[model samples]
Target: MRAPTTPLRPQPDSLWRAIAAPMSTGAPLARDIDVEVAIIGAGYSGLSAAYALQKRGVECTVLDANPIGWGASGRNGGVVSSKFRLSFPTIASTHGIDVAKRMHRLAHDGVRTVEAFVDEFKLERARFEHTGSLRCAHTERALASICAEADWVRTTLNDTSMSVQSRAEVEHETGSKGFVGGVLSADAGTILPLEYVRGIAAGLNARGVPIYEATPVIDMSREQDGRVLLTAPGGTVRAKQVIVATNAYSNLTEATASYHRELVPFRSAMIATAPLSPELDAQLMVNRRSYTETRRMMKWFRNVDGRMLFGGRDAFGKEGEPTGFDALQRAMVALFPQLKDVPVEFRWSGYVGMTFNALPHVGRSDDATTFCLGYNGAGVAMASLIGQHAAALALGEKPELALLAQDGLRPVPFHALRAPGVRLVAAWYQFLDAVGA
Candidate 1:
């Protein structure tokens, strides 16, 4: 892969770089060229594609409008738990039992892939500890639902490790005493988002994958010979195949508007407290395990660098996205009243693409281009795993997993009425959770 005569560079104001340290970048591409494949968006999906393809001896170029991990892959909750939040009956009904099971493994094992990379590369940024995750519940019915789901997965899916944690155990485990009970994931873990991205990008680049930060694929067209032509400001790239890995930022890409109509951009916000007192850390977490409470507007968090970093809530709208710190901080205190006066050191929010069905779409498009996207907000481990499968599909290999690969392209009903559309749905959920309806 030759460098272009000119290369794409990052914009003046990149988000991740604003808060985190800088990433080392290579020289820009200078001219139009072609490769085996071309990918847009440098987040998990794009980087994962580059990593997997490079390992397979495929020469590919990756472009991102900002630095690697600058998007949600760098800004998400960083919970690598692999439980598919959607119910089994729904998944099995849509994609069939066989396909659902494979996708299930793909989801859970996404975390394993991350663990393997961290182990192989020995990067400090991938500081993952597997204490397992806890899903705390507020009601007996919710707890029963959790147990029933776990039993169903273990019995039908042949995953026996899935089990239920008693209410007493959950209260002991998460240090959050507000819940009556919870579900414990014996196989889950957590990581620092930016750190994980850096480690993977660095490891892949070291192994000869051409990972380009600050390059944006402005538009893509098809060639007569069946290759894809991806146009960036610096130059163009032609490839035998292309993968649309832009999850949220894909909205900014011209082709993505149609793809994202059913996919709503939700603002997931988070706040991190000043380092907890040594005493607080010991009493606050269960083996440093990560957790997400059973709220309609759920609260999820884990330990990071001595701070209790927690995130939850759909930013009511664009305006809410910009100022979620106060609400989240107050929510944190309300849940764990002991930390009432703690100062939250950092706060940030980014959008996650969601589908009404809550299932991610991965399939071939009308233009013969392949797509692997819409993991809802659970991209940490799932993105890497799905990208591998998507790359396999791009190579024309049949995927063994049963996913919503060939679904319709219909927009979510009432998108123009989101305040009435989604906001009402959210309100209903909150009401149901509150009144036990």
Candidate 2:
């Protein structure tokens, strides 16, 4: 008798990141074939691994429950950064300064990689932007924290993007008058999420790496020879090494047991108004710089095509439905105080797999032949690079990047309780916002 395969937690929906129209999806994996590596989940991580593995002349098959970029990669706000998902000090305390530095560099380089990809491939879907970003403080008390953070980066990390943003700079730049000040970093920007995915997929396919959609790895069992049996609805694939890059929509595993606890797959919402007047943008943003707040329950915004895209996590309770456009418009008005009359053209929501520490978990594991998962919230670039790390580590080409080695992914203690924990945290913030505390 065969027991039922475990249910993989559902991935987030592509609300705002939805295509203006239906896009093209590729073929499926028909028959099982032996390969040097098998990667699950076709977001940035999966696609990146395909590119890297192909470059090294390795046979790799990318499997996705849906299509590439169909997950959070295509649905997320396009801002990319390696800014500690948790605070940097915490990472230094845990992974030490050297590893922490490497993490920061990995994230910062995602910007360059995307830009380079755009230039080399000439992909029209990705809108490569270097509009810089403003990490602003919503409260006076919070100002000191940013200042300390900036000082630490400069004196210790030798980083220098922590310049002060006087109230005038904030007012003049964002055009959303008000606020004490903030820091402007030139190390980030926005892009059309889907374009980024399609471009990467197309490039990988051109290089002969096969990517299959509608193929979910249903169940897996380890063979005596340490090979893995990945059973999908159609058939089973046997592979020597596997890399699991499936975040929110991934199969939870005995191998990924604790990671489920460490990561929180919660829904966040974003709505873009019909392109506002071009003047509205010159007034709203200096150079399309990404803007996020210092509050615990923060809102982030970016400018695109004369439209303002605002994202926030406090949309509603469970089930993750997009609040009607009217509600979102009202929230935007409250934030800008000037957009009360503006109209929104698109609204969408999706789930992001957030690690408790908010940083990414990389490395190979002993539980699986070779596997790595959990990106917390920062996946744009880090996740992309992980494919390179995972495949490389799996092929014995880069032993340092193995998940079973130093700096491997750690599972959270009780992921089954994550929704409850997230609810408790969300409840407190919801209360704080209610009282203006």
Winner by lDDT = 1
Q: In model 1, where do residues sit more than 4 Å from their true spots?
A: 1-22, 25-28, 89-100, 319-321, 407-410, 413-420
Model 2, stretches more than 4 Å misplaced? 1-22, 93-96, 251-262, 318-320, 323-328, 397-410, 430-437
State candidate 1's TM-score: 0.90
* lDDT of all predictions: 0.74, 0.69
* Error at 309, model 2, angstroms: 0.7
Each prediction's TM-score versus the true structure: 0.90, 0.87
Alpha carbon deviation, residue 418, candidate 2 (Å): 1.8
> For candidate 1, lDDT tens digit of each residue in 149-213?
78878888987756788877877776777888877777788876787887888888788777666
Cα displacement (angstroms), candidate 1, residue 263, comes to: 1.2
User: What is the TM-score (0 to 1) of candidate 2?
Assistant: 0.87
Which ten-residue region of model 2 has the weakest summed lDDT?
1-10
Q: How many backbone clashes does candidate 1 have?
A: 9
